[model samples]
Target chain A: MQHFLRKTVAVFESLGDRSLDSFERLGRSTLFLVRVFKSIPFVFLRPWLLIQQLYSVGVLTIVIVLVAGTFVGMVLGLQGYNILVRFNSESSLGTMVGLTLVRELGPVVTALLFAGRAGSALTAELGLMKTTEQFSALEMMAVDPFKRVIAPRFLAGFLSMPMLAAIFSAVGIYGGYYVGVYLLGVDDGAYWAQMQKSVDFHEDFMNGVWKTVVFGFVATWIALFEGYDSVPTSEGIGRATTQSVVNASLAVLGLNFILTALMLETS
Target chain B: MTRQILEIWVGVFVAAGIAALFMLAMKVSNLSTVSTGDTYEITARFDNIGGLSIRSPVKASGVLVGRVSNIKYDKDYSVAVVTMSIQNRFDSFSIDSRASIYTAGLLGEQYIELVPGIEDNYLEDGSDVVMADSALILENLIGRFISEIISK
Candidate 1:
């Protein structure tokens, strides 16, 4: 009885410590996010740095986005075609695929991929710079590392995410077409006709654009915050990279659910 | 040299995204489907307009002819008034044509389907389609089934 009581007390104590640690981290992250936003003017001042970061973060990730997008779209086409066929409404496969991709899967998938690829890379790069005392060196030279190093990368990530997501969606629609029209023998005209009749520009497509913009902001903010706050060690760099991806993904999904509910309720 | 290339690539990327968005608007969204060509409006009255709304397609023999332009409740007749815009090309529908609300599939959207009669004269603009059939309400059918079972 004494041992059990002691174990229970220890568990509660650890839980309390974890909650307090999380709250502190949250406060620090919010401050870091604000500081990053404040440094946006610096990004514009040195447009070269923003361009360099955009190339590294956005351009480098294109191949993966294209490949993942094509596969996702093909799978959706196959599955949607089969299900719609069951109801003798296979002609609406285009509408089903288009709506599903634009409304939900497109933004969500792009955000997750960006988190895993660009977010982790950002965390590692910053964490390594911190571990090597490079930030301190910059401070010695009277350079604000936040303005010079972090701002451009954060802005690039924010800008690139929406564009990458749009490209993914476009490629995905073509993949769906390849499967549904070329392979499954669904009527080409009916597919496109149904899509036009059903999908609304403001309701579906622009809503997706809105979602990606929000996701880009949240994911990049998390990535930058994790890296800036990383403990100055090799292990800390590794941990920060992993945590950056995981946290960004969770934030994207949670924010998606909330945004979806709000968008639906209002519209 | 690399800076110029990267700048060009970024411009191309932005342009591609915009192009895709424009294609989506043209191909999938209803934005481009609004008929700006010549069309005439007509009204129909029904007792129940179940699952019907503006922008629903107006079809004749499985061919889309126009769209429902507006819907209103008539206080004097205690009926639903539905206005449809028919294209000029499909102006051959007769004055005695019957308009019935129908579902595309078992659980699909409702549309107004017109069946032409043997009348010599064609329907004019601002004319009423007097033989309007109301929509089939599924709930009412299920309730009737349950009541019949209880009585039996």
Candidate 2:
């Protein structure tokens, strides 16, 4: 009976502790976010720092976005064509591909890719700097690490996502067009005309823009916060890197559903 | 890599992204535009629009010439009023040009087809298309055909 009572109390205690731990992390991250925002202006003052980080974060990520976008679009075209052919509505291939990319897949997929590629890299880099005491080294010279090291990377990651999403969507549209019109013998003029007739700028495209911006913000925040708060050990750095990717992906998918729901209501 | 090389790469990346956005605005959604600044407005009334909505294409001789800008029910007249904003270059349409609601294909989008009528003057902004033919309802057509056959 005493053993059973101890097990019950331990389970309750474990659950309570984990929840409290997450709450505390949330509060700390909010403070970290505020500090990052405060240092943003300082980051802009030195454009070179931001540019260099942009090279690492944004430029390097483009190739993947483009290649993935093309394949995704081609797949969509093939599937849409096959399904639409059954209904004798193959002319609508353009509308289906264009709307699907602009409304959902473009933003969501690019974000997931960004989380895997840039988010993990950011976390690992910051975690290593912490492990090597680079943060303290900067502080020893009376230089604020947040302004120099953290904020630029955070800004770069935040800025990169939307641009990447646009590139992805555009490339995907081309891929779909190629597959639908060239490979499948669908009429090219009818494809474009049908797409132009259906997809609305205000309703489909702008909503995607907002989704990417929000995703960018969440992805960078999770990445930077995980890195800055990491335990200063090699093993801890690895753990933090994993946590960054996982957290960012979950945050993105969850936020996507909410944003999509809200956008649907507005449109 | 060197900072200069990195800067160049970033510039190229940014340029590509901007280009992609331009393609999306121009070729994807077409930026929700009727494609010109100088436009003229003309309203037409139909008994039943039959799935016609705002932004539906307005065509003449199978060529897209304008877009439907607004649709409202005229309670007093018990009809649907459609406003079209046509590009100014096509201002040569006669004042008596009539519009018919047309379905493009089987289970396809509906649009407004303007049929030109010989007249002395051209249509200007804010003028009405005097004769607006309503859309054909498939169910009503089938019902009428069945009733006629049974009566006969």
Candidate 3:
């Protein structure tokens, strides 16, 4: 028993040492990222990063947004209508659609879709670059890898998230309208009119937009951090990609709670 | 490259369509009469304007015709003063147009509802709607009812 205890202690100490080393490396890369952000004015020197981010966030993810938004809206409308039908208060569909889409579904669904698609891709690309020593090569040439690779992606993810959230909100509301009005046979005028009346500028739309910004930062930062720290091996690259998706998704959810709490407190 | 270009065009179209739909829906709803030269202003005072927001609809007989334009606190009256823009078609609103803050449903939004009265004097733009009602918040009403029942 004593021998087992000793072995366990030794294992724990080695694990702790490894974790400390990883954190130290993370600290350095984060500082490097900060420096790259400071030099964003020089982004005119490399427009490809912006284009790449735009393409990745906007153009590539349209189908996912469309499908997800439509399905989610349909489900919400169906479920909400089921519950509301008990009271014979079907006209509250507008408030229901507006509230659900703006407060919860808009930001959360978009972030999840982004994580599955662009977030994974970003991690793998960065991980491969790290594993191939391409990052080191760029450094050797006095080219800042953070500026060339990390910053552009970070900016792209950040900018793309809000735009995606907007699209998600718009599409989701329309989806709800279609399902509620046409399919479910609810009054079209009341469904839309109620939404217009119920949805306030400050409470609904602004809160949704605010949450997306946080989601963007969390997704980009976690994905980039994971990729930047990948070990120089195929296995390491694979591990980093997996970690990126998991970490980015978790971070998106975690930050969403924090933002919701903060918004509630302030409001 | 061709695929990318096509994809970009599709995205733009999708985005534009969504935006246009929202605008069209808002236009068709006609909640506010700001566009049709049918807007008239009226003021209401409330003791508390809980969750009352600018641009919230003003409804009469469940038909929307205007919106809350501004809100302010009256120091002398110790009340919240809400200014609303009603349609000029509702121009024959009497001096007794009663404004009440009511919820759409349980756990839903709040809007100012106007119950038009049959008094002689007509309410003009910038005139005060004499009778005003505040929201009977659910918690407060329930609490009062429960207390009364318990006491009884």
Candidate 4:
């Protein structure tokens, strides 16, 4: 009885501690976000740094975006074609493929991929910099690390997500087109026309764009924050990088659900 | 230099993103298909709208001439008041024209079909269409058939 009571007490104690830690981290993250935003003006001042970050963060991620987008789109086309043919409504294959990609999969898959690839990289890079006291060195030289290291990377990531999602959607549509038109022998004109007829620019496309923008901001912030808050050790760096990717992915999916619900309700 | 090459690549990537957005807008979305020219509004009341919704195409003689812009329940008439915007170029609707709800294909979306009449007068902006027919409900037809058989 004593041991059981003690164990229950210990569990409650740990739970309380965890909640407290989470609250502290949330407060720190808010402050960090403010600092990052405040330093955004610095990004334009040194345009070259922003470009470099953009290259590393955005350009480097293109290959995965393209490959994943194509495969997703092709699969959608194949599945959509099979499903839509049931009611002799195979002509709606384009609408299904286009809407599914533009409204949901494009931003979602790109964010997940970005979290795995660029998010992890950002965490690791910042973690290593912290591990080597590079941030302190910058401070010693009167350089604000937020401006020099964090904001440009944040801005680049934030900018890249929407663009990458757009590319993903575009490639995905083409992939669907290839499968539906060439492989499945669907009428090309009907496929394109049906998609255009169904998909509203403001409702579907712009909503997706906005979703990516929010996702980009979230993903990059989590990655950068994990690195900034990392304990100064190799194990800590590894842990932070892992946490960054996992947390960013979970945050993105949760935010997508909320955003989708709101968008659907309004539309 | 490698730096210049990187800059060029970044520029290309940005441009590609823009192009992709443009392609999506043009080929995948209804941005281009939506009429931007002058339009005239027509209102009609129906007893039942069925599955009629906003932005549903309004057709004339099997050709699209307008779109249903809004749908609201009228408390006074206890009916669905539907507002449609027709393109100015196709401004040939007579005052005695009939507006009926139609379904596209089988089990597809509903639209409003405008049948022209031989009246000399034309329907102007904010014209209230008096000759409006409500949508056909399949369940009602089956119910009526059952009732007639029971009575017989």
Candidate 5:
């Protein structure tokens, strides 16, 4: 019993040490990122990273955004019309649709969609690389894997989410317009004019963009961290992929709350 | 690689063009003014404006002809002074044109519906329309309904 207790204590101590080491590495990595940012001109000069990011954030996820935007818009319009007709106040359809799309739906839905697409792909790619000892080979050759492997994805995710968010917002508003004017037979002039008047472009647009950037960072960081720290087996790769998606999704939601609070307080 | 790059560029252009067209359609549908020959202004006083905001459509017989330009409080009268810009083509709006604050749909928006009067004399600019209906406040209506139910 004494020997077992000692063994358990030793295991706990090793875990504590490993956690401390992880924290230390995280601090060093953050500092490294700061240094990299200082040399951002050189970083931006590399077209490969930019193209990768654009592809990840914009081109690859086009179908998801298109489908999500259309459906959400349709539902919002249909529901809004039902509620408005109850009070015979159908003219406010534009305001309802515009506000819903800009403030909430645009950022949240786009990020969720991105998490499902690029988030999963990123995790799988990184996990496979870690499992195959590719990362070990890079380290053996004295290549900084973080810079070569992780940084491009990090930068891409950071850039891509906001661009995707902008597309989502624009398309969503149009979808709402389509349902409101054509299907509902609401006066088109009234709908557009009210939307234009109520929605302040800066507040909605900038807030949406800012939220997406934070979402991007959280999604990329969690996925990469899971992939990098994965156990050395096939089962470990599977576990890491699952954990990556779960953690990234949770982080996205938590960060969204924090950002919304900050924006409200500052505004 | 070059072909792939060209394809991406084409995709980007097409996406941008589609977005621009949608924006253009929305703008043209809402902002363009109809030339109604003679311009007239009518003032309607209401206790509450509700969702009667600026540039909200003013419809007559389900046809949009003008818009509510402004809403201001009449300090002495304690009423909302709503100014509507009507096109000149509907020139026969006499003293009896009934203006009602009505909503487009349930959970939709509020607009003023103008019922043209039979009197031949046209309303001059800045003239007050005598027949005006106050906007229905949703909360008040609900409260009144609940109270009635309780009383019964």
Candidate 6:
């Protein structure tokens, strides 16, 4: 009876501890976010750091975005053609491909890819720095590590996302055109005409840009936060890197849906 | 040397992004409309607009001439009022020119198709296009098909 009572107390205590731990994590994350935002001015002041970060994060990620984008567009062309053929409206293929890529798939897919590619790298790099006491070394040298280390990468990731998304969407449209027009033989004129008639610059394109910007900020924030707070060990670095990718990807997708709904509903 | 190379590549990347955006705006979203010289406004009333909304392209002979600027309900006339902006270059449309709402495909966006008339006199700004055909609603057609089958 005494043993049973002790087990019950232990379970309750663990639950309390879990809640407290999560609350503490939330508080820490908020503080980290503020610190990161405060470090933004340093990104402008130290342009070379931003450029280096951009090269590592942005330039390196371009090929993947392009390859992924092209394939996605081709698939959209094939599927949209098949469905539209049933309705005897295959000529609207361009509208389907353009709207899908520009409004929804482009930003969302690029962000997920960005999260997987850059977010994980940032987390791992920072975690490794932590493990090797590099951040501490900077502190000892009277350097603000947040401005020196974190700000440039954050700015690069934030800036790179929208540009990558734009490229993806553009390449995707071409892929769609090749498949829909050349492979499937949909009327080329009607395809473009339909798209031009339907798509609006202010409504679809700008909304997509807004979404990617927000996603970029969120993704970079999660990556940097996870890195900054990771335990100073090899296993901890690996875990934080995985967590950063997973968390950023999920946040991006959730925000995409909310933003899409708000954008579509409003205008 | 490495810095210069990297800067060049970065500049190329930024240029490509901007170029892609320009294509999106100009070719895809019709941003060239702003450069389309001055336009004259005209109004048309329709019995039913169906899915026609503001900014729907106004086409002449399958060529884009202008766009629908606004849509409002004409309560007194029991119809929908559609305001259109026809470009100055294409201002030769006669007063008797017919305006019809047309759908490109079986399932596609609706647009305004203007058919030029024989009248040599041209339509002026703020003039009402009296002859107009409303859009054919799909649901109504489907209903008619069902009712015809029932009667048969």
Q: Itemize residue pairs with steric clashes in candidate 2.
A: none
lDDT of 3 by residue, A1-267 (tens): 999999999999999999999799779767866876776655657876667566765668767887888888888788888888898877778668777887788899899888878888888888888888889899999987777777778887887787777677777777888888888888988887667655655666668778888888888777777777777688988898898888888888888898889887766
| TM-score, B chain alone, candidates in order | 0.86, 0.90, 0.76, 0.91, 0.77, 0.85
Measured against the true two-chain complex, the DockQ scores of the candidates, in the order shown, are 0.50, 0.64, 0.14, 0.87, 0.07, 0.51
Task: Give a tens-digit lDDT track for model 6, residues A88-165.
Answer: 889889999988988999899999999999899999999999999999999999998989999888898998898889
Most TM-score-accurate candidate: 4
Residue B151 displacement in candidate 2 (angstroms): 3.5
lDDT of 1 by residue, A151-212 (tens): 99999999998888888888888899899999999999988888877887877888998999
TM-score, candidate 2, chain B alone = 0.90
What TM-score would you give candidate 5 relative to the actual structure? 0.61
Best by lDDT: 4
Give model 4's docking category: high
Model no. 5, DockQ: 0.07
Runs in model 4 lying further than 4 Å from the true structure: B145-152
Give the CA lDDT, 0 to 100, for residue A171 in model 2: 90
True contacts kept of 2: 0.75
Which of 1 and 3 is the better model by DockQ? 1
Q: On residues A1-267, what C-alpha lDDT tens digit does candidate 5 reach at each position?
A: 999999999999999999999798678646656643554454466756556555654577777887888889888888998998897767878888877877778778888887778777777888889889998899899866666677777776766676666667677767877888899988888787777656644455457667877887777777766777677688988888888788777877887788888877765
**Error of model 6, residue A188, in angstroms:** 4.9
After superposing candidate 2, which stretches have Cα over 4 Å from the reference? A1-24, A188-202, B31-33, B36-40, B75-77, B92-95, B118-128
**What is the per-residue lDDT of model 1 for residues B1-152, given as tens digits with 9 covering 90 to 100?**
57799988777766876776777777767778665688899899999999998878899998888889899999999999999999988999899889999987889999999898988888878989989999999998899999999999
4 or 6, greater by DockQ: 4
Per-residue lDDT tens digits of candidate 4, residues A179-213?
A: 99999988999999999999999999999899999
| C-alpha lDDT score of every prediction, in listed order | 0.89, 0.92, 0.78, 0.95, 0.74, 0.89
Better of 2 and 3 by lDDT: 2
Angstrom error of the Cα, residue B12, model 2: value is 2.5
